[model samples]
Target: MDQKLPTIKEIAKRLNISVSTVSRALHNHPRIGLRTKMQVQKLAEELHYEPNTLAISFKQKKWFTIGVILPELNEQFFSQAISGIEDVATAQNYTVLIGQSHDSMERERMLVEAFRKHRVDGIVLSMAKNTDDYQHLEVLDKYNIPLVYFDRIPKGGQALSVSSNIRSGAEQAVRYLLEKGHKRIALLKGPDSLIASAQRQEGYTSALKQHGLQLDPDLIKEIDLSPEGTRAALTQLLALPQRPTAILCFNDYVCFDAIQAARQAKIRINKDISFVSFANLPICNFLDVPPLASVEQHPYRQGQLAAEMLLDIVEKRKTITDIKPVILDTELRIF
Candidate 1:
């Protein structure tokens, strides 16, 4: 390979300063000294040091900047989550660097690497839909930077996590439907790649078992989330010999599609079929006729807790591995 570009480790070594000092100076952090920042900048310019060229940080010196990477920013759930994260970061006098992965694992990895290269104090991440491998995340460990996962986390508890008690939320919703006299309840399952969705599937089965309802595999459909896909799933569910009286959707977005399809099929929502969804986004409250109920996932709370856990470790006030997970409980919203 061609001569490798200069890195922060080399720059810090040459300047006789900590990597965090170099990172803070480069980013013009307020806590850094004027003379130190100028010196670090001069040395960085001379070395042509780019963020991507760095892979290290200073001991006992934090840059006070956090990186937040999530699946998509446009969605209401992610947007609300970001607000919670920002609230916590602002209170702590820390800057947040946000990146959207758009549910692409490659994009998520790139963002994580970029954050690492910039020497972020820590990262708060909600993994992408296709993030089946997590070898890339090991870089944070090598560098000793902390990370906290929320919402859609990876397998094996690789990092501190904050999320809604998803299984309990699903169980609560299913039990509520049963109380409403819905025996043949259909489920629209999300992709298996998401841990939260998988947990919800298990909760659905557990609720059925708890209530002595026989498991009906045919009543469960994997939702591609496309309009066509939602329509097809609904069509199949309605055509069953004993059509379901209620449907449990993966999320509010899927429930919205189900409502539209149910209406197109001339089924009056409350009269002909009942529905329940997860993730109580604000959009659902604005619906003219909301689903009979939805499980309040508290995405904002998840984000808040995720940021808090990462900051605790980043500031060395707590150890991530030793910290207990912050699991936010859900509420059932009946419309």
Candidate 2:
């Protein structure tokens, strides 16, 4: 039979020290002298002793891990956000665990609950489009767990958040189209339930009013942030009595699909119709008909800010009163 591994008790007995003393010395407690700690550590190393993570966690009352919940990870936007999160987390000596909601409310709730069960130090969330009720997030409050929302945030405020100025970005896109000699412009908005979509629509409407362009209710189309939805929305927009000369899309994926639908319908890009999309994805370059313009929401910066906020909360480096919402600015990426 294989020899049983030596326990902390065995080490204490062999060292002629009390079990409590040995445990403190092995953990490098401040109360334990350096000589005793060195002796215990050297003996433990020679004995091939491994500290139990459970015991360590019990003592520290922390897992030193963070949970990141995202709507989708397949998109370049979220991928870049994760990159920023990883950078900050690695530097701070914290581990990051990821969970994807797949834009489903049920999945989002499950992920949040699982993270709570795991007792992560904090959570960074980019809410799903279908997420309506935020009572699940109130669980974090109930548990005294810190949560920082990023990109897409929950409705109703006082929640900590780091995001781009979505309304300003949308307004800029709409204003650009109006300046391009396009009178009848259309908008491809995300689902209405999404806070980001609502904010963007508000900006779009504001821009239209600013330019003396009547808000055409028929030109505003709301669809899911999917290629299929974009295709369907574009089909409907093109079939309208007065087809728009330019369309503002929700994001790069929608723009890709809209371009495809336009081509299939024999509509020329940059001449017959133009488009401006948000989230300047890499795939935009590979598209047969690229967007006329795109918005740079600085997703990487948003990620960095969100991660920094979470770490600050964990380390108690700052108080909630000192914490302010970080709203990064956007720039128009003209094609």
Candidate 3:
């Protein structure tokens, strides 16, 4: 009976050769004789030998697998970023296992533990919206797994991260609104727990200050990223005695809520109020009035860069002697 999936040791025993010799022959090592190489290969094929990656990894301590944790994949930003990550991972012969946190810290923590249990060589992560505390991430240190963050990263951390320059993007957006002669600019800011949101808020204020425009305390409202939250903020802003002439939304999708709010309040968009936000969605261009402008944070390239950094650390090709942020810029659209 054919031995089940012959091993290098088994083939060596059958051929009366050393296991090292059998291994070398199987790999076509330069030291192995061509005839001997052919013989070992033929026997391996006949025996239906298949190398065990998991067993091999036990020795090398590298699974050649990367765990990628995303907030969610429904948005084009995340989908594009994942595509970029896959591009680099596949080329490097590293398998990617994906986990979605659904913007929940608890789920993210569980996913981290699961990835650690699998002994992934490294991890690529984008934090959840409510992830203010990063204690859950410390678990990876115990397993010596390299980690890198893309987009939605934390304000404080030693790990490397790739992200769009949200501050600059928001500054640009605010400036664009100012140039159009809109002084009363309201910010539809995201939750303070999000670093991106904080940066965008910072940029909004910075631009207003730079242009000699006073920052209105009441004009800035925190968006919960929910329809109800958006509606409330919009209603409050519209009800103000001095309603903002331009609204800087947190994201493209939030613009939809802004538009809805304006319609119900009988406020004209672009004519009465303009909207500018981040990650210009595809539908942004197709909207009836479209956004005055939007920030194009290139999520795909952010993912690609994050993967490159993580792989470098995992391979020890480039050691991060000192911790530093790797910031990427938002892509520019024609209009």
Kindly list the per-residue Cα lDDT of model 3 for residues 1-335, writing each as its tens digit: 95466688988888888989988888789999998899899999988898888888888788999999998788777999999999999999899999999989999999999999898989999999889888889767777887899888888745689888999998999988889899999999989999888899999999999999888999999987887899999999988999999999998778788888788888887899988888877777676777788899888898898988888888888876654668878753524
Candidate 2 displacement at residue 211 in angstroms: 2.2
- What TM-score does candidate 3 get on C-alpha atoms? 0.91
TM-scores, all models, native as reference:
0.80, 0.88, 0.91
Which run of 10 residues does model 2 get worst, by summed lDDT? 280-289
Q: How much lDDT does each candidate structure score?
A: 0.87, 0.89, 0.87
Supply the global lDDT for candidate 2.
0.89
The alpha-carbon lDDT assigned to residue 117 of candidate 1 equals 88
**What are the runs in model 1 whose C-alpha is more than 4 Å off?**
1-60
Ranking by TM-score: 3, 2, 1
TM-score of 2: 0.88
The TM-score of candidate 1 is 0.80
Residues 1-335 of candidate 2: C-alpha lDDT, one tens digit per residue: 99888779988998899999998998779999999999899999999998776777778787779999998898899999999998999999788999999999899999999999999989999999998898888889888789999999877656899988889999999999888888898999899888888888999999999988789999999998888888899888889988999999988888888888888899998789999999987777776668988999888888989999999988899977789888888888887
Residue-level error in angstroms, candidate 2, position 166: 0.8
- Residue 96 local lDDT, model 2: 95
Candidate 3 regions exceeding 4 Å error are 1-3, 10-16, 33-48, 332-335
* lDDT of the structure predicted as candidate 3: 0.87
Candidates arranged by lDDT, highest first: 2, 3, 1
lDDT of 1 by residue, 1-335 (tens): 78888887898899898988888899999999999999999988988777762222354467779999998798899999999999999999788999999888899999999999888888999998778888888778899888889988876654588888888988998999999898999998877778876788888999999999999999999876656888999999999999999999988888999999999999999679999998887887788889988888888888888888888887778776579867788888887
* Winner by lDDT: 2
Per-candidate RMSD, Å = 7.7, 2.8, 2.4
